[model samples]
Target: MVFSSESFLFLFLPVFMAVYYATPQRWRSYPILLGSYVFYAWWRIDFLGLLVLTTLFAYLMGQRVAAHRGSRQGRIYLTIGIGGCLLVLGVFKYLNFFVDSFAALWGTDAAGLGVHWRLILPIGISFYVFQAMSYLIDVHRGDARANARLIDFAAFIALFPQLIAGPILRYKDLEHQFEHRRHSAELFCDGMARFLVGLAKKVILADAIAPLVDLTFGASDPGFVVAWVGALAYMLQLYFDFSGYSDMAIGLGKMMGFRFGENFRFPYVSRSITEFWRRWHISLSSWLRDYLYVSLGGNRKGAARTYVNLLIVMLLGGLWHGANWTFVIWGLWHGGLLALERVTGWHQRAASYWLALPLTLMLVLLGWVMFRAEAVSDSLAIYAGMLGLNGFINDPLLFGAMSRESIALAGLAALVAAAEPKLWLIFSNAENKGPSGAVVSTRFPAASAPRAHASAALAHQNDGWTVTLATLVLGAYAVFRLTEQSFSPFLYFQF
Candidate 1:
């Protein structure tokens, strides 16, 4: 179940949290593992076994790697562990794509080739497999110790908050928290506030604007205006939708006394594509950087090799998203741009925001066209319309499909997406100010005070009656929409 669903929000979460906190500290992992399994099984019971098997395989392999550290056996174990994870991912996620592509290349029908089996990809397979691989690699590399307890390791692997769609936590990042974490009224309140904000972003904003995007992209021959409008709508929809889920995941992590790293950071404001990757999907980008790019020798190689490495990493990174040619092309498109930036020094030009922002956004918007399209040809058609190769006319069908509410919400979403950084800064400054125009300090032990004060500051920022009223209104509206509208699955869930 997604976080935005009524059953999940109203039923599963409350019950899970109640059971979780009520369990004793020593046996808490039992409830967490069980709850996490139940959450995964809610999607498909059969895949639950696959998840367990993968987790156990990684755990065992990690132990072997740790036991044989600094030896050939350790490297062997590490290779086996990573290979096993990738094999599972490839079979489930990419098998069909590979088969079809091969058949097409060979001028033969895939069905006649006797490959009749069709794999149903488990939800979140990509995310959890990456985490499992990272865990094994970290253990082998001596960055983290292999967990002795199966339950703790399993809990870490299957943490429900991030199991489905993730900020992609590494084992090292969460190892200590799995063993010891504190839950309190302050953290819970802060988490609730964050969750509510994300809920509004998804339900009130993203879902509202999704229809216009659907109408335009689904058109037989959308005009230039329709195509651009749809593309822009989708740009806003994707940000709010995926980032909203990330926010919910993070907020849930906080409530459970675990800290997930930031995922998105006002990527729309990026002045360069390089800067955009740094801000967007921070976890995945860092993962590719460390595991893929670094493994390919990174920039330590010459400029020419660095460009090649960049291309290979991005191409594979795109393939990791899905078994689709559009994703591959999307990856290649970004890789080419990144390489051009490096070779031409456009990235270092220090262009002003007025010049840089639009250019960067336009590039990003064009990329999203490929990402959202069902096929490469559809993406090309959208691109053609975007470039005015189709027609400059505003399609009446497209204009008629958008409601006034959607248009207004789209405008609001764009404004919020652009202004969110400044809005947060203003709120932060206001939160730090005291009634007497001075900073308030709490007296506590040095180590404890900072954590306490930070939590307090978050609570303070969200504590105002105005914030409360706004949250309630937005939440109520979102709930109303949820009850009335059809299910709107998260976009990233397909990956």
Candidate 2:
């Protein structure tokens, strides 16, 4: 079930929270594990078994790897663990693509070979499998200890909040939290506030802009202006949609006394693709850097290998999203840009954002078209249209499909995305003094102790109330809008 859906928001969450909080501290993982299973099963009961088997297999292999650390056995177990997870991922996620591509090259298709069966990819398989593999690798590397408790480990893998589309969690980061956690009214309240804001982001912003995007991308021949508009709207739609999920997941984790890291950090404001990776889908980037790139020799072997490593990491990273050739090109686009930046020293160079921002955003936007496209030809069409090859702006079908509310909301989405960092900073740190979050900035001059302190305290109080009231209103509106709107699945779910 989607976190924003009525059943999830009004039914599952309330009941889950009630049961979870009622459970004792010592056996908290039981409820979390059970609740998580129920959540996954809600999608498909059969797939739930796949999740369970993967979790248990990883747990068992992790123990062996940990036990044999620094030995050939440890390395073998690690390889086995990773290989097993990848085998599942490959078969489920990419086997179709590979089969079709090979068949086409061989002047035939799967049907000709009597291979009519197509593997069904379990939802969130990529995320959980990656989580499981990371756990085994960490155990072997001594970065984290393998949890002896099967329930705790299982819960970590199946944690509902991020189980689907994730700010992918690592055992090393959450191992201690699984064992020991603090629960309080304050933390829970903060979680609710955070969750509400994320709900607004997804329901109000992303969903609002989706129609325009659908029109543009789905059109037979959306012209230059329409294509740009669609591209820009989609850029906003994807960020709010995926990042909204991350925010809600993290907030849900907070409610359960788990701390999930922030995934997006104003990636649009990034000066380079290098900086963009550092900010966007940060968890995955770090995972690729540490596990894949480093494992592939990183920058250690030589300059050429370093570039190759970057390209390979991004190539696989792209494939991790989907089995589409568009994704392959999307990955190569970023990977090639990364390699180029490294060679040109552009990533390391200091430049004004005015100079850097547009260049980075244009490249990112173009790559995003590839990421969003159904096929290479579709992407080329969008690119051609973007260049005015389809004639600038005049697309009657696109115009007819647009709505006023959606247009207004798209504008608002742009504004919010642009100001996202500041908005997060303000509410998230409301109690802090001044707009800049300083105790003695322009609003509170260093002066007589009592007067200054009292004024600052009053200001902080106002900010706190404002944040609460604003979030409540936004949350309520988002909820209302959600009830009125049709089912809109998150874009990242396909991954």
TM-scores vs. true structure, each candidate: 0.92, 0.96
Task: State the lDDT of candidate 1 residue by residue for 208-326, as single tens digits.
Answer: 99998998889867888888888999999999999999888877987888878889889999989989999999999999998889989999989999999999989988998999999
Cα lDDT of model 2 overall?
A: 0.88
Q: In candidate 2, what are the lDDT values of residues 1-495, reduced to their tens digit?
A: 999899999899999999998898889999999999999899899999889889888988898898889999889988898899988899899999998898889899999767898988889988999899888878887898885588888889999999999989998888789889999887788788878888999999999999989888887677987889889989999999999998899889979998888788889888899999998999899999998999899999999999999999999999999999999999999999999999999998835547898899899999999999898888888888899889986677677678988889999988987888788778767634332224533355567598778987787788889998999999999999999999998888899
Residue 198 C-alpha lDDT in model 1: 81
Q: What is the C-alpha lDDT of each candidate?
A: 0.86, 0.88
Q: For candidate 2, what is the TM-score?
A: 0.96
Candidate with the greatest lDDT versus the true structure: 2
lDDT of 1 at 336: 91
